[model samples]
Each structure stands twice: as structure tokens, then as C-alpha cells.
Target chain A: MDDETRALIDALVADARESPADLARQTGLSAEEVEARLADLEESGVLRGYSAVVDWDRTDETGVEAVLEVNVELDRETAYDDVARRIAESPLVDTMRLVSGDYDFEVYVRAGSMGAVSRFVSEEVAPLPAVTSTVTHFAMETYKERGVLFDDGDDDDRLSVTP
Target chain B: MSDETGSEAADRSDGTAPPDPADSVEGSDQSDPAEASDPTGEGETTAGDRFTAADRVARVPPSGIRAFFEVAEAHDDVVSLGVGEPDFSAPWPARSAAVASLERGRTSYTANRGTAELRRAIAGRVERYGHAYDPDEEVLVTTGASEAVDLAFRAFVDPGDTVALPTPTYVSYEPGVTFAGGDPLAVPTYHEDDWALTPEALAEAGADEAEMLVLCYPNNPTGATMSADELDAVAAFCVDNDLLVVSDEIYAALTYDGDHESVATRPGMRERTVVINGFSKAYAMTGLRLGYALAPPGAIEAMTTVHQYGMLSAPTTAQHAAVAAIERCDDEVARMRREYDRRRRYLTARLRELGLAVAEPSGAFYAFPRVTDVAPDGDDEAFATDLLDEVGVAAVPGSAFGSGGAGHLRLSYATGMGELKEATRRLERYLDGR
Candidate 1:
């Protein structure tokens, strides 16, 4: 991407709620220019979509989160894709990606409770024909997520000056 | 030869041998020139009394902007909007290049005109404005745009010549001209007209008699800029009056809303213009002390001669850093400019919301807001002092700039957003309590 486009993307990444006018003012581009460039970015898949960075812990419907390492017996033709797709289709799965090292896939699963997560892993995930083994690690506390730091109190970014 | 002999006779009459030019020249190679010129204690004089400053130097007042910084520094908890400097550090590539240069022991001075690579880079950059300066003949690297201003004034302005300058400026041009033995004729630009310099104002300031006209776009203190058509009119006036133009585009890269149009790019202006720009404001490279002047060959030669005698050259390592900045830091500069723009809009909007009459600055990182509503006697200095004393939010009085700036305040938004917001809050509370 061109520098201007890259800057535009950076601005959006920093604050997705910035209006076209705000983006234009910030990027030194006209509103129309920002709009056109944004559309181009969307078309090129450089900008997928914008979503809220929710503090799930603050909400009443907070879910139990765990990281699952799945070692799969790859079907030589389809590789790990077939087993990975099966695991991704589950509702409890928040994120899934093929990983290197001993694990074939690293998956993030979230459920209403710890029991639900455990039940899903044991009953659903372990039953997958290609899934050879699975290891689950539950999250204790999230200190930071998606660049937002929780419980960061009294952090003053101002420089110390006498005046 | 007669004048030299006459002066020598006068010196001998005073019981001090006349300084033999040859001995003094050779003595300079072995010892201090001042000491060599007067080796005996008979001519012993206090350092301060030995050399008197020129009348023009005495005529110029101490910088009001610097005084404000001192005041700000003296007070604790002062949230200063007084400084014009950017809070951001210099971009990494520029800093890294300087570090690399130092590691490689590249500590000696470069060409007095600056490194060829930097000059060429500058030429490439300014080409966007449609002025293709021959880097070899037309560019001179300077300590900063400040030095460039001093050099341009000294180069073009003869003693007692007048240099027309717009008021509510960067606070250096007037003194720079005065120090160079020129009179600075203040051309008043009012907030009523958004502070843009008009041709009428130029004529009213007596441009006909003025040898030069100083222009600063994305102007400091006022944060005002002229449109291309507005600049065209000013150019026409300069052409009509046969005035050399010293255009300080130091803040050119920080211009918002539209592209900055250099006065030199206008018709009939190239031959008579000196464009001064620097890395400080644009790339956050203030401490690097690097800047340049783009002028015609004759003007460049004149400035270069002054530069050679005065500074020799800009810092060697900084020049290398500037090359990196010019080549690889456009994206970083653009990023910083965007941040400044965001702050500008926020501060302008917030200041207006607090009932201050602020001309939303179209360029630079300052908001020139009228604080007459808050000042008991409509005094900007009093208002600024009171603001600092009461709320600890520091801002520069408009009067510090010039008479035309008497009722306003130059609030720099170069600080972070959090500080700006807090400063605004303090200002609001201070105003409300008053």
C-alpha cells in the first residue's frame, strides 16, 4: 500500500469510530479522498471490518475462556484443513488457527461456564476422528486484551515539567 | 591606504603600537585574535566593554516568547501551551542514522553548503511545489530555519533598509532583521480577516520603501495561512515593489486543509524569493538543528558566504540524519502531521465551546484564541499570567507576538490529547470561576 493509504489504515486501527471528516482532518486528505481510499481498502481486504473491543468481564454474560492445543493426525491429501474446519464449526470456539511445533491447531474456546467448556472439549472435540489428542488451559485473568489494559489506574502520560 | 595610515597614526598617538595586519593575521594562527591584537595589559578592557553591540542589536527587545518559556519553567504544575516545540521525539530512521554516523566516527564537518545528498533530497522534496531548485547552486544548509532567516536578512538587507513583516509572526523575523541592521516594518494582519496577509496591508506597511517582505505560512503564534490566490496577490505586490521575498515555510509540511503553496512558485517570484524550511517542525528533529534555504544562485551565494563565516556548516551527523529523514521518513512525518491535525481540531473546537473567539487555525499546531472575555481588562498578558497562577495551565499571551496580537493567546496543541483536554478543562473552570 502507498504511505497515505497505510497511514489511513493506521488511523482506523487506532480509532475505528473516527468519522470521515475526522479521518480527513487527521490524514490531511479531503473527506472524499478519505471515503474513496477507505472503499479501496475495503475492496482490497486490507480493512476487514470494525468491531467494538468489549470488556467482557464487565458484562453480566461473561464467558469462560480457554486455550486448546489440538494435535491432529493429518490426512496427507487434505492435510490438517479437514480436522481444523470440523473444530472451527463448533459454537463454543471463539478462534482457531493451524499452529506449528507439537500442536497442529491452537484454538480459543469460550462458553457460558467452565462446565460447558469442559463438556464441549471432552464430548465434542475429543470425538473428532482426526483429533489425536487435546490439551486445555483455562484463562485466569485478562490483564490486557487487544491493546487495552485493564485496571491501569493513575497512568499519567504527561511529561514532568516545573511549569 | 590613507584611512589605514590615519588610523595607525591615531593608535600610535595613544601610546599603543598600531596592530600590524600581518602580525595579527599570523598571531591568529597561534593565539586568540583578540589577545593578539592587544597583547599588552595597557589596553586591558572588560570583555563586556571592549566590544559594543551594534545599534540595531540594542534596538531589538528580548524575545517575548522565550520570556514566557522561562516563566513557565519557574512555576510548578504549569501545563504549558506556551512552547512551539513538538512533544514528539524525532522519527526513528533519522535518529538511527545519526547514531549510525556517530558509531562510524563520521564527526567532521561536511560541505559548508551542506551534504550534496541532503541538498539533492531537499530539491526532490520541493519539486512537489513546482520549484525545481538546482541543489548545487541554489541550496545552503543552515543550523536551523532561524539561521536561514538571519542569513537571508544579512545577505539581502543593507543597513537602514526596511523589511516588511506581518504581525503575530514567529517572534524571530523582526529581531533577525533588526540584528542584521535592517528596520522591520510591521504589517498588521487582523483576526477579523483570519490573519491572512493582504496586498493592501503590504502597501500600507510601506512595501514600496521596504527592501524585503518576510512571509511565514502556517504561521506561528497565529497559525494562519494564505490561500494560493491570496499568496498570488502578495506576490504581485512584491513584484510591483521590486521587493525580495524571504518566505519561511518551516511549517509547510504541517499545513492542513490544502497543500502549501510556496510564494517562490508564483510567477515572477522565483528570482526574488528565499525559501527557508527545516526538519524541526516537520520531522520532530528540533535538536538536530538542521534547516535549508532555497534561493536563486546569486542569493544562495550571498547566504553561503555568510554561513561559511558564521556556522561553517550544519552538524555533520545531523545532515546524515536529515538524509534518512528525507528519504525514509515521509510516512512518519505524515503520521505526525495527522496527529497534529487531530489535536488542532480538538483544541479549536474545545476553545470555541468555552466561549472564546478562536479563528480555527487551518495550519500548524496552535490555536490563536481571543481571551478578552476572560481577561478583566482585556489584557492577554494578564490573562495568561492569571491562568498560570490560578489554574496552572500555561499559554503564551498574544501580545508577546506583536501589537496586532494584543488580545489573543497562542495555545499550542503540540502536547498530547490528554493534556490538551485537561488544559481545556482547567481553562473552562478558570473562566467560569472568574
Candidate 2:
């Protein structure tokens, strides 16, 4: 990406909800210029989409979060993409990525409870024809997410002095 | 104004020269003459009378910039664009480092020069600008770039010497020179030329007779920076005139259009130049009071001598934090610069849209817009005062800077986007009424 586009993406990454006028002000471009560039970015697929970074723990809908490592038997004809696509079809799968290590895919899964995750792994994941082994690591707490620190209290300790 | 023999005799007995009567008169004249005459006056004794301040101290006017801030502070809901400080807190790593230092009880004073680690970090950072200095011998940590500028004046300026400073610049340079017992010669740069300090202006400002020249790029108030070719010309002039150059690069990191060129990095200029920089603008560490000066060993030695006698060393905890800033906060600094650049562009464009003439500021977070078209009497201070009173939008009068600043107003974009937008809206309404 060009420097200007990269800068725009960086700003969006920092705060997705920033208005085009705000972005224009920050980037030294007019609102129209910012709108045009953003349209081009969206059309070119450089910008996938914008979404809210919800703190799930703050809401009633939070579920058990776990990272699942799956070793899958690769098909000589279809390869890993087919298996990855099948696993991604499950609503419990939050994110999935093919891997290069012992595990063929690493997936993030969320469910109502630990029991539900265990049931899904045993009843659905383990029975897959391509699945070889599976390991699950449950997340305890999130210290940071999407660049925002969660627990650090806002206290400025620097001495207050005139410049 | 007393040169009474009783005082002079007392001074002479101590083998000190008699105080100049003319200087005493000039010193006492700034205050109420009645108070100076009456020792038993109810009012508090002024510092000038209590201590023997140099005559120049009395001549130095209180910073006009501070007066506007005081007026802004008196009102509620004022969207102040007068302050020169950044609104963002210091980056997390730098602040966390200070907390860690405090938790570890590392609070004692550091070496007279500074902590070795911080000096090393400063040396490494400045090297990117193509200047080199040995951390041990050539770097001295200071209490912000303010102290560095003061130390430079104290070390180099002698009585009756002249210090030539470009006009519409930061307010501190002139006073620093005056306090050091040197004459401050104003070099005028025109807004027509984007306030660029031309070689012709330098010569006209009496650079030949001046013992030192103070150059602040990405300047305060004006927000002007010299190009590489411009700097080369200024460097050549300094070389030909054998003038010591004290270049304040505090705003060096804030330049938007191009890389900042330090005069010290110029060929044949390093030996005679002292570079002043700090963590304030770049890392948002203004409250930490951490800055440093990079100069040749001889000049550093002289500044260190004055520093040791006065400041001893910069705050130890702040020094530790500064090391963290220099070593780890490069990304944070860049992030803040981008934000400032955005604000600079917005503010400049908005001011121009309001029918004022504004030069696109290449650096710093301020826009100096000519206010004569809207000002009632073509007085910048009056214009700024009226704006604050009418619309609660506070800006600094350019006259507070120096010569060639009378027709402009300096508006800072260090505030948030919301406040800046509100301030511009209010300013537009106020100007429309005028």
C-alpha cells in the first residue's frame, strides 16, 4: 500500500468509528478527498469492513473462549482449504487459520460453557474423517484486545511542571 | 537607583566593583517608583530589588503569551488554543518506566552531566539526523530544552555581546540572551516568504557583530522550518562570521513535509554548533522535564559547569523514563506526529476558509494566521483578546513572539479535534460579527 493508504488504515485500526471529517482533519485532506480515498480503498478490497470491538465480558452474551489446535489428515486432491472451510462452517468457530507446524489448523472457538465446548469437540470435531488429534486451551482473562489495555488504571505519575 | 557610598563602600570593602548607578535606575524603573523609594511599603519586595538582578532583567517584559493564558483561565468553557504543550499524556512505556523506577526507589540525583544510559540514547537518536556526539563527553542532560538554552547563553554570552535571533520565534531565546547580559538583535522574516529566515535577513540583523546566533527550526509561534538549502546558507553565514550557532531542534520531530535537517549535521558546522532537543514534544513528556544538549566537549564542559552549580542534574526518575522513550517509544512518537499533522492541516485550512491569510505550517502544532483583515485596529493582541472575550476561543498574539509578528495570531492545534472544530466555528462567528 502507498504511505497515505497505510496511514489511513492505521488510523482506522486505532479507531474504526472515526468520521470521515475527523479523518480528513487528521490526514490534512478535505472531507471529499477522504471520502473518495475511502471509497477507492473499499472498492479495491484494501478495506474489508468495519466492526465494533465489543468487550464481550461486559455483555450478557459472553461465552467460554478457547484456542483449538487440530491436526488434520490432508487430502492429496482437495488440500487443507477444504477441511478448513468445513470446520469454519460451524457457528462455534470464531476464527480459523491453516498452520505449518504439527497442527494443520489453529481455531478460536466460543461456546456457552466448558461442557458445550467439550461436547462439540467430542461429538463433532473428533468424528471428522480428516481429524487426527485435538487440543484445547481455555482463556482465563484478557489483559488487552484490539490495542486497548483493559485493567491498567488511568493514573499519570509524571511530575506536573510547566514546559 | 541608589549608588550610595555606604553600599559602594561596603562592596568595595569586599573587593567588588561598585554597582552601576544607571543600571540600578533602569532596574528599579519597571516597578512602582514609589515602592522602590519606600523600603517599608506594605507590598512585597520585588526580586529585582531584593537581589542584584542584571539591568537587562528589569528591561525584559513579562511574557505577553502568559497574559493571554491567564485571561483564558479566568473564564469558564474557554477552548484554549493558547498553550504550546501537547494535550496527549506521555506514552505508556515512558510513564511505566518512571513508575518502575519509583517503585524500585531509584530517586537519587544522577551524575552531574546525566545518567549514562540516557545520554547514550540521546546520542543514538540524534545520529539519525547525521550528527555524532560521544555520550560521555559531549552530551549533558538538562531540565527540558529550556535549561539547555539557558545554559548555552550562560556559557557563551558575555556582557555587551549580541545574540542574533530570527524574529517571530519562540519567546524564550530573547530573554535568555538578555539575562545572560547580551543584547538580543531581532532578525525579521516576512510572512510573505512563509517566515523563512533568509541569508539576507541574517546579515541585516547584524550577524557579523553578534557573538552567537539562535536558530529554532519548526519554530514556535510561526511554525516555520528551514529547508536543506536554506540551512546550508545559514550555516555558511555562521561559518564566515565565526558565530557560534545554538540550534534548538526541540520541534525537529514534528516536521511534516520533510526530514528535519539539524544545523549541527551540516558540513563544517558540527564543531561550532550546539543542538538542543528534548522528549517533550516527541514523546509527550513535557511534565517529565527531560531534555539534553549535544555539543563539542569544550562547550559541553562549560554548560555542565553552569548546570552543576545551578541544577546539579535533571530529575533522576525522569531520566530513566526518557531512556525508555528514546529506546522504545518510536512508534508512539510517530503516532502522535501523525495526529498533530492532521490537526495542523485542518486548522490551517479552516483559518484560510475564514478569509485570513495562513501559511501552511510545515512543522510544529501551531498555525500563524494574519489577523489584520479581521482585527479592529490591526493589533494582534487586541484581536486575540477580543476573540477570547467574545467567543471563548483563546489564542496567542503573534506580537508576543517578536518583530514581524504584530499582524498575526498563533493558534495551537494541540487540543482535540472536537475542541479544535468548536474553536474554529466560534472564531468564524466572532470574525463575522467584526
Candidate 3:
């Protein structure tokens, strides 16, 4: 991608809600060009979707999240793929990725409560044939998400008038 | 010639003002802070035949909005559009470079022209706006563009030589020329012309009498700018009249319309122009105080001589920081310029809706809106005061800029949307009450 295309992506990543016209003005691209590129990016699946970085503590939702490290001993190479596909389909799992680290998979799980998360791990995850050991770390609060910091308390501290 | 130049420079050095006692009283509304500190009035001994400020420095009145600043500061909820500054922090890489230099213990004074690294960066950076300065002899890193302006005047202007400054310009230009013992000639440009200085306006103001011209665009106080065609006319006028141009392009990156073209790029103009720029407004590095001047070899050498005496060099940390800023902050500047443009559009449109005539500012982050309809008796001072008192919104009165800026108010939009929206809402409420 060229610099302008990269800039357009960077801008959207920062604030997806910014208008096309404003994005164009920021990136030195015309609004029409921005529109054309957006469509192209979307069609090619390079630009997947836009979502808010929600501060759940401020919202009325009751959800708990945790990081789960699952150690699975695969009997065969095909067993790893079968286990990964099965875990990805679970409702409690937000994201699951295969890794080269100590753990076989680092899974992000979100459920209604800690009780629900514990139940998902005990009943759903460890029951797999290749699963060897499981470790779950509960997240207490989120200070940041999606590359954005929350409530930094920064304000306009400059004097009202200056030269 | 060397003796003559040396003697005059010495005269200026010796004539530098002793701290004026009256200077501290500039912004007091009722109570003097000095009186409280010295109750016995022992400070009165200063009046008896003692030397005062040099005539030129004393002639220009001090600038203040202190009374207003105090009043606005007292209010916890006041929404201010008064300061000309960016809302962003200095680019992280720039700040990190400063930290890295500090870690390396690079705090010693640098060469008077600044570190060769920063001078080279400045030479490269000015290329964006078409100024081709040689790093060795044609560039001087200054404490800030304020010092660069002063250096330009001292380097070129003889005592009593006139310098043409377009009115409704930044606060520093007029006084800087005077401080250098040059007469400031105020040339006017009106909103009818969108505040761009034409040859006609220059000629009408007796600009031929001046030996130097100061140009700032995207201008402060008034967000006026020069198109290439407009700058061509001004360049022709300067060339015909044998004038040196001190072009302050500090706000060059914030031009909303098109890319800024340095006047030095004009035909036969590079030899006679000094292009001044800084990292303050563009890079949001105001506190770092890094600025540069690009000029001909002789002029830069002369300015460097002045800088060597007053300020030996720009800070080493700041020079290093500016190198990082110059090399890496174009994307950040583009991002900021985009944000400022949005605010410019919103603020100007909102002001027009409130029954004011704001000439759509072409550059900078200010909108100079004529406040005749909303102000009492078209008095912007009273209007500004009443707005802050009644609605808790603070804006600078247009009259403070110059006579041409009378009946208007300069509202800087280099603030966040929340503040701009709040300030304008209070502005509308204040107008309704009036």
C-alpha cells in the first residue's frame, strides 16, 4: 500500500466514526477517492469492520473476561487442527489463536460471570481428547482496549489567553 | 564598515532596558501586586533622573489581557478560545528524542548556529515550503521564532530605518522591530481583500519608506494567507522598492487552503528574504522553544552574531528534539492540520450563524469574526468582558490586535471540539442576552 492508503487506514484505526470527507481532508485524498478506496478495502476484506472500544464498566452490561492458556497434547498433526476448530465454535470464546509459546493456545473468553467462565472451562475446554492442562487468568478491570487508553483525565490546562 | 557595525551593535547592547518599574503594573485592574509586596513605598527612589528604557523600546506600549485573564481564570467553568496553541502533545518521538539526549548527557552548549544536525534538518524541512537554505552559512537555529524575528531585524535594519508590518498581525512583529531601533510602519489590509496584502495597500500605506517587510501567514490574530499570485504582487512590490522580507512562516503547516509557498521562492527574492519558522505551532513543541531562520549567507552570519551574544545557541536537547520532529512529524502535522481545518469550518460557520461576519480564514487556527452586531456600540472590548462575565466564555478582543481588528474578536480554534462547541454555545447565549 502507498502512504496515502496507509494513512487512510491509520486514521480509521484511530477513530472509525470519522466522516469520509473529514478523513479525505486529513489524508489529502479527495472524498470520492476515499470512498472508492473504502469500498475496495471492504471488498478485498482488508477492511473487515468497525466496532467501538467499549468501556464496559460504564455500561449496563454484566460480562466477565479472562485469558485462558490451554495446553493440548496432539496425538497427530491433524488433531491440533481438529481441536482448534472445535474450541473456536464455543460461545464463551472471544478469540483463540494457536501459539509457539509454552501453551498450545491463548484463548480470550468472555461470559456472563466468573461462574459461567469457570463452567465453560471445566465442561467445554478440558473435555477435549488432546487437552493436557488448562490455566485461566481473570481480568479485573480494563485500563485499555483496542490500542486506546481510557479516561486519561487530560484536559486543556493552557491559560485562557497568551501571546 | 566593520567598525561602524561594531559600534552600533555595542550601542544597542548598552541601551538594553533596565527592568521598568511600571512594566509590572501593566495588567492590574484595581490592586497593584507591587504595592502589597513593598508597603513602605521604598521603590519610589527610581524616579529621580535615572535612565529609563531606551526611547524606541519605551514608545511601543506593552501588550496585555491580564485583567481579562485574571477575571476568566477566576471562573472554573470558563470556555476559552483565546490561546493560539495546538491541543496535541508534542509528537512522542520528538519528546523521546529529548529524553534520549538527556540520558546521553548531551546538555552542553552547541555551536552558535546550532548543532550541524539540526541546521541540516531545518534546511531539509524548509524544502517543503520551497526555501532552499544552505545548512552551513544560510541557516541559524534560534531559541524560538520570536528570537529569529528579533535577529532578522538586528541583522538587517539600521537605526531609524522603517520596517513595514501589516496590521492585525502577531503581537511580536511591531515591538520586535522597535526593540531593534527600527520604526514600525503599520500597513493595513482589510477583510474585503480577505486580509491578503496587495501592492495597492502597500503603496497606500507609504510602504516605499520602509527598507524591510514582515510577512506572517497563516497569520496569528487574523488567519490570513497569501496565494502564490498574492505573494507574487507583494514580492514585486518589495523588489521594486529594494526591501528585505522577513517572512515568518511559523504557521506554514497549518494553511487550510493550499500548500504554503515561501515568498523567498519568488523570482529575484531568495537573495533578499529571511524565512522564519519554528516547531511551536506546527509540531506542538512550544515549550521546547526550537525555531530557525533561513537567509542569505551574509544575513545569517550577522544574525548568528546577534544570537551568539544574546542566546549562544538553541538548547541542545531542543535541537535534538527538533531534528526528530523535522524528520518524523510530517504525518503528525498533517493529522493536526486536518483537525484544525475541521474546527475552523465549525467555528467560522457557528460564528456566522450567530450574526457575525467572519471572513473564512484561509490558514492558521484562528477565525477573526466582526462582532458589530453582537457587541455593544461595536465595542469588542466590552463585548469580550461581558461575554466572560455573563456567559463564562473567554475570547480576545479584536481591538487588541490593531485598529483594523477593531469591532471584531479573534477566537482560536486550536482547541478540542468539546471546548469549541461549549465556547460557541456560550457565545450564542451571550449574544441573546445582549
On DockQ, the leading prediction is: 3
Interface DockQ per candidate: 0.08, 0.14, 0.29
Q: Encode model 3's per-residue lDDT on A1-163: one tens digit a residue.
A: 9756876887788679878865675566778999999999999999999988878778899999999999998775657779988988998898899999789999999999999999999999999878989999999988888877787666666656654
Q: Give the TM-score (vs. native) of candidate 2.
A: 0.81
Q: TM-score order of candidates, best first?
A: 3, 2, 1
Q: For candidate 3, what is the TM-score? A: 0.81
TM-score of each: 0.74, 0.81, 0.81
- Cα RMSD to native, each candidate? 11.3, 8.3, 6.7
Q: Model 2: clashing residue pairs?
A: A26-B342
> Is candidate 1 or 2 superior in TM-score?
2
Fraction of true A-B contacts recovered by candidate 2: 0.15
Off by over 4 Å in 2: A14-25, A28-36, A53-163, B1-55
Which of the two candidates, 2 or 3, achieves a greater TM-score against the reference? 3
List of chain A TM-scores, every candidate: 0.85, 0.85, 0.84
Q: What local lDDT score does residue A86 receive in model 1, on the 0 to 100 scale?
A: 80
Candidate 3 Cα RMSD (Å) = 6.7
Evaluation by DockQ, superior candidate among 1 and 2: 2
- Proportion of true contacts reproduced by candidate 3: 0.38
**lDDT by residue (tens digit), candidate 2, B1-434:** 00011122122122221222111211222233432432222344555555443456656654464345456667887877876667788889999999999999999999999999988888999988888899999999987787788899999999899999888887667767877888989999889888888889988877887899998888887888888998898889888899999989888889999899898888789999989998888887766777789999999999999999988998899999999999899999988888787678778877877899988799877899999888978899899889989999888888877877999998878777667889999999997887
